[model samples]
Target: MSPIPTGRLFRTGTGSDLVLSRTFRASAEDVWASLTETERTARWFGPWEGDAAPGRTVRVQMAFEEGTPWCDLRIEACDPPRRLALSMIDESGAWHLELLLAEADGSTELRLVQHLTTEDGLGETGSGWEYYLDLLVASREGGPRPDFDDYHPAMKAYFEELPARAETPGHVR
Candidate 1:
């Protein structure tokens, strides 16, 4: 069975945001470590090295991507254990992403928003984030990582239709 796509696209005056969230039964500080600390991140997304502060640039290894490419990512903003914003430009184009963390009742919710100038390749982009985020979850829980094949083509159609579905009356945003 295919994994269900959980990302939602919200339109804005300038463009749109592709948002996906994951809930963890861990403290915000712990989740923040999984996102920020290089050693922890290496297990899920990839390891990053540099000064790592707002306005600083870091070299990150896309450990899961083809060829395991390296890219320079700039830290747009960082509010420890709460919010982080980053931007990078590569052969694929520019990527602007933000993560917001909220904690309540001993659980933390990590909300990821990708600011997009256009909805051109959401099918591919959306599935990619889903796979990475799930990898984060699996890393934390000591579970098996998700297969990309179970995400990409399987969930592509759902993401491709989100813009149209969001336009329909009574559609939940």
Candidate 2:
């Protein structure tokens, strides 16, 4: 298997975003269920419960975290089998995230983008996403969950070194 993939950073008028993606040899519908279904998600990221709809809030358990803390997550958008956008606020501050799915030739690619208020915590944030996303892959593939240690401090420098994206008058450079 390949190592964790690297993400590209982009600067927008509101803030910057760090985008990472993983490809799965499954249909978009299957991948979408793995992302949105409570039981499916529990096998990977965590489980969530509450009225699920655009603008509604749900409580999600960070199962892999030290204390398995529960956090409130708001659903911003939910276009099944294609895209889902959500946000959360915790001790770390507000986080806006989007998951986009594209399928081709019987495979689906999941692109996860986290809107950043600042580039300050890219190292920690990027590593956390990498680990969780990989866990999603393992869960879908029926493989064992990977150790977080393999992604953190070890992958810190790589994330820290990602270039800052600057936009020109008409386009991003």
Candidate 3:
């Protein structure tokens, strides 16, 4: 099956925001653990260690990536069972990301948003988030983790086309 690129790009104060969301038939607390707790996150994204707070930094390993590259993530905000915002800087540049959770009728919706400063790397960056989010779904629901290869080239066009669509008035796709 092809990877689904269902993210929406919206104009934000900084630049643009790429938002991807998934609704799970699980409690917000459970979903929150998966997102914040190190052991649970290792199943989907990667493992992280360090004191986590609004102004603290944590070292996270990109377990799925080759060489298991590690990066320092600065916690920007933390609202338990609701929202968590973090930032990181690497060779590419600075990245600001947020994870928001809302629960209704025993189901939780997780929204992962990346605040973009430029649209240059949307294709690669968006696809990576899609793949990782799907990995989160699989880890929770019990299934094989998705392969990055399946997401990149296949979902590239869909993400690359988002910026232009966001600019056009009345365009909804």
Lowest summed lDDT window (length 10), candidate 3: 164-173
Give me the displacement of residue 71 in model 3, in angstroms. 0.6
| Top candidate (TM-score) | 1
List ranges where model 3 is wrong by over 4 Å: 167-173
- For model 1, residues 1-173, the per-residue Cα lDDT tens digits are 66778998887666788889999999999999999999999998899999999999999999889898889999999999999999999987899999899999999999998888989988999999999999999999999989999998988998999999653223222
lDDT agreement with native, every candidate: 0.90, 0.86, 0.89
**TM per prediction:** 0.95, 0.92, 0.94
lDDT of 3 by residue, 38-119 (tens): 9999999899999888999999999988899999999999999899999999988889999999899989999998888998
Candidate 1 global CA lDDT score: 0.90
Clash pairs, candidate 2, are none
lDDT tens string, model 2, 61-155?
99999999999999999999898999999998889999999999989999998877788878898888999999998998888898998888878
Error of 2 at 144 (Å): 1.5
Give me candidate 1's TM-score against the actual structure. 0.95
Task: Please say which candidate is ahead in TM-score: 1 or 3.
Answer: 1
Q: Comparing 1 and 2 by lDDT, which wins? A: 1
